[model samples]
Target chain A: MSRHRLTVVISQAAGKHPVKRALEEALVAALIMESGLDVSVIPSLYDLSPDHTGRLFLESVHGDMVVLSWLFPRAAFWLLDRDGIKGHLGETLLKPAADDDDDDGEPEAPRGIGAVDVPERHIYCIDLRDAATHDPFIDEVRRIAAECRTRREEKDRAASKPMMVELGTSLTANGTNGTNGVIGEHAATMPTFTAEQLLQAPGRRWYPVIDYSRCTNCMECIDFCLFGVYGVDGLERIAVENQDNCKRGCPACSRVCPEQAIMFPDYKTPAIAGAPVGAIGSLKIDLTRLFGGEAKDAVAQAVAERDRELVADGRDAVGMSVGIAKRQADKPQGPKDDLDNLMDALDSMDL
Target chain B: MGSVSEPLTFMMGKYPAVLPAELRYARNHMWCRAADGRARFGFSSYAVRLMQDVYFLDWQVNVGDVLEVKQSIGHIETSKAQSDLFAPIAGKLAVINEELLKDPSAINVDNHGTGWLFDMEHAEGGDAGTMSVQEYYQFLEANWENTQRILKGQI
Candidate 1:
């Protein structure tokens, strides 16, 4: 039998995030029920900070497979982009860092530099937001578990040393992994950084700050944001609750706010540059697509014109410039019968 | 039934992804171009860019099967998330992109061209009633903000 040892890191308190807890439990159940292997789930809390989780990931080996699970895409975005930890993994997973507003002027060194064993182990990000219903995510977990088992079997035959270091301390408080899987905790002796310190650190300036004067308490930002970036204060007004939870290079909340009340001090919005000839009109259409406006033509014409410009500029064009494509449907001709047929088809497919 | 072939161009914010005018769009972000009543479909460039790395594309329907508007015809499993591919219009299934079976990355690399999902013989007088590119563009603008929030786990 293949033994699959899985490690899941939670960035927030379980009491605060019932969804992540539910997902973690659901995954544990599915792994046990689906794979039928000796599956172990190790859970840890990192508060979405680099020093916390990065140290934990590097310090010990838990099992054959390690999943750096996060509840939000922003966490994955931070892990891959702003945290500057991808260098430790031997890959440049993010683009340039000019996009974020870093507080410290100096460049920071990569966390877990000499500690990460990239070739011997692998780490993948699984956003747990849809872990319960998204079969693909579940399928991916099973696939990874199988791969981990295969790799472990191969390594065992090659006389390789044991990958997991036995847990010395009690971690039953964290969670259960088949009743025996070891859940690792941060080393107590390791100094912990507060949220304030993290905010002041280099490459960590992606949090939002609200301007009270222009603020309308419409509560859209509060409802739209899932990372706890916005919370109602004692006065019952929206305030920046957990700044550390904000993902770098993401100015989404501010963009969504109708009052334009939310602002990010750390991110510099890229300037829209002037385009020549037909490019200006195309840019207008793009803006309409982004901000909302009635355009004279559909997205296709704008795309084709843009492609033509790219081809003229010796760049790769996006659309098929040669084919005589069909025009789009302008109005809804009615869908009652189609919808009923679809419902029936769905019933047959059992999806 | 407006001018579907009107030559035009547009951009979505600062992102370089282009939404083609000739293709009718579904809210799920797939686009369809119909010819001889047979509609060919694919993911919009903007949708492809958001998906980033696509590892798998599995079709649930087969050739000769009839599908309805909004019915899931396939699933796209990307590096970040899994999304259902819905039909842009009610139609009879015609062909699936065989090349995509070998190289799924083509969906991300050539989304507007060879990365098309499949084709369907659109049912007569049973118009799928999809959005025109301009209307879809407007819809994207109206929803882009919230969609970004949703993707980031803010909503």
Candidate 2:
């Protein structure tokens, strides 16, 4: 069978442990498997240099599905318009109203599977957090797979024209310049902070500190960070566009900052202390307590009682003396009669 | 061979260092060995440590089946997630470990030994191109640091 490609993009900050990465990978794989689709898990797309983030976005546009696990509001806005693709994840989940059809006779299309102007192929995007919490996420993926299969079958029968399809992720916090405004102008805009603002000694949410003394204005940190945290002010000063939307621990902007101007005090602290002990390795069972020392005798007694009940009900027909005696009397003559019939047929046919 | 008392001496000091090696490392953290020219493979200790508890092992390829490099051979289910295991090298699968199908926890207990997944005969000249033990350690170090940065939102 030919291989079908499905690309998964996990947008997370750098510095996560291998265990967490493995957990995320396993979760995504399980979701894919629940849909009953054959999948090949790709190595992760790790921290992209600011210069490379745009190129990476372009490359990721080729996937059948693109998943944005974290809340990168600005990045979602920027990637809405690029053509030659299926549906988007953030756009569908974050703003379901952006979808044109309310009743397509399908459950809310999974994150990636929907119609783009280009073709009938569907792309799905899932919010990692939402997927972790909601059982519906699994159900939705299965539904989307069914829909895609149905659509594909119909297209094959009708000999419909093939459509070009691509999937992508938008990393910029502010919406890209195109059909959808950055940060979604129509939706109720939430407060967000740039990495620079977040790094400026955690305090009040507004008026994020932009260290003009170390500002390079390269916009690299802005490009790398998914949240539209950094923007140029009227006086050409780098400023925080939105602060409230920033997740408490994500410091993507500071990691990408070449100038080292952006700094946050509590940003890098671990959510939990110590190396996490794996849950599976610590499993314990007390069978002795569950089933006392007389378990073997009890099992034997139960088996004996079950056998006696079956014999009394004549359900053990094969083991009955009368049944065995009848079989023994008929067995020899049954095969001999079959052989005689075969010989008679051969003789009559003059073989 | 070392003396039997060596264990006591080592235990008194510290356990033998089980460094993450490169020779047996898969991109997904599995290991491979060449046995009589056939590739014997299993999950690395690091992979088991990462996965924690393996409840189920599901294989995609069957015996006498040809597999390509980077192909997904099967998946292992853990409490947290279902992780796919990729074929590090291309070859025809010779046999699978029936024990893992019956008792998957063997992988977490003795990942390098009785927990091996399958044996494969190289198709033509299929080579795993795996790293040495030292190289794998370096890879893990780099990967660990990168993962940390991503988690911290630094990258």
Candidate 3:
């Protein structure tokens, strides 16, 4: 075994999001039996608390880490930071396609690579949507592990000699100079990770992660959500309380949040899946409502999508009866399309 | 009356999709314009109007990748659906509109101009299966109902 194993965090998806499940399963099945990796499957990272057992175990590690979760890279990076697992964001060449592939300009390593308690350690936060299939994921993980081994080997040379000299002095003082005694002391440094050491329990959870940067605390989400997935904290700010109460595959609540703050990171659609397209323009779930495209209004579509899930779940369709509120200045108008301008022109005549 | 719903009907009253006479069109609703023997590609206005809104787009192929006709080069995503973008003409990808990846709604705003998908180098057999603007419109009229079904998610 290597001197220190890199912890690979597999944050399990909440609902049976089929593609997420399939890719996650493929990854876990392939990686679990590997010797060098310390793999742990915790519940969704978005819902994790700093005090959670799994998170505490994660923080205890003084080495490299990899986090696989259903979140945008930006969201996932901040989520890890929120959970007290901090490291420089590891760059992955694997995007669906990166905006700029050339790395010639930024030649040096990012500023804070080894400037901490753990030198040369990084947190490779891989979005499950980073690729379509598991081969890319598998290749990336193996590559990361190999890179970690190389870093450790380089660090060991500089750090190991001083430790050995110090150990000799301590051993002589204790009159334990035998080869077996040295062997025993060295063996004590070997890391111990068993099935029970992983702190978090396994449970499927699905919920919205409020990007507080964008959330205006409008309570529009709380008002719009039929399920009790959202609630207020002591200060009455929105929080995802009762996350599992979120209806599976029903992203209707996301469509209704006028601020576009809600993100179902595992959700299939890019904006809902937490792609950083932008705040307002990207999150406009019904972009057609701007131009003369959509047949139904935003609220109507959301209600229909929500009601389908409700009916499927053997519940009554609320159908705009509950959680429907008139939003004020709901959407910031982009420069009007020709259609919008025409509609404005016609509406002025009041025909 | 064609009575085709959405984009087609919606476009009929105001600023219908104008097909440039010089451009060549693939049956899959992609347009290819030749510049200095290289082909520049994008979604046709009809295709863009049919899509309604483009929320996100990502290329599946790299800039240097050699592609074949009908090969899914990337996908364009709107609020409701994600559709693969097939290569309109087969050649090595010379340039992709990286700007459009950031804000794919540009496709909805200007599918013909700044919203072009990619360019191909030393592109081959440009006239093979492509049609002129009139012929493409004829093809649309011929397959109007089936095309309507596709747009309506029935097929």
Candidate with best TM-score: 3
RMSD of each: 21.2, 28.8, 16.0
Predicted complexes: DockQ each: 0.02, 0.02, 0.03
Misplaced by over 4 Å in model 1 are: A1-351, B1-13, B125-127
Writing each residue's lDDT as its tens digit, candidate 1 over A1-351 gives 334454433332234356566666666666666532333333322233445434334334334333434422223323332332331221113222222333322222322112222335555455454334435556765666566567667877786554444444643243333444533222211233333432232332446655343466767666655456778766676767777776554565665454444555333221111011111211111111221112223234434444555566577765534322232345356656432443343333211
Q: To one decimal place, how large is model 2's interface RMSD in Å? A: 28.4
Summarize candidate 3's per-residue lDDT along A1-351 as a digit string, tens digits. Answer: 235566788877766666688888888888876656667777677656545656665665546788888777656764665355667767665665323323322322222212123223688888776677878877888888888777767877767642422211122223232333333222233233344544355454466766554667778778887778889876767777777788876788888876556677767666676666332222323222112122444578789888887888799988988888765357566788543543443333211
Residue lDDT tens for model 1, B14-104:
7666776777776667778778777787888767766667877778889899987666566666664555566666778899899997788
Worst 10 residues of 1 chain B by lDDT: B146-155
How do these models rank on DockQ, best leading?
3, 2, 1
Please report, as a residue range, the 10-residue window in candidate 2 chain A with the lowest summed lDDT. A268-277
Q: What is the TM-score of chain B alone in each candidate?
A: 0.85, 0.78, 0.82
On residues A1-351, what C-alpha lDDT tens digit does candidate 2 reach at each position?
111233334443234545446656665666655423423322221222222332234233432444444322222212222212234332243322212333322322123212224333345554443433334444555555555556555765676554333233333343232322332221112122333322222232211223333445766555544445667657655656665545454443553444444444222111111001111111221111111112222223323333454455565522222211132346454555332443333233210
Interface RMSD of each: 16.0, 28.4, 14.8
lDDT of each: 0.50, 0.44, 0.64
Segments of candidate 2 deviating more than 4 angstroms: A1-351, B1-17, B20-23, B124-127, B149-155
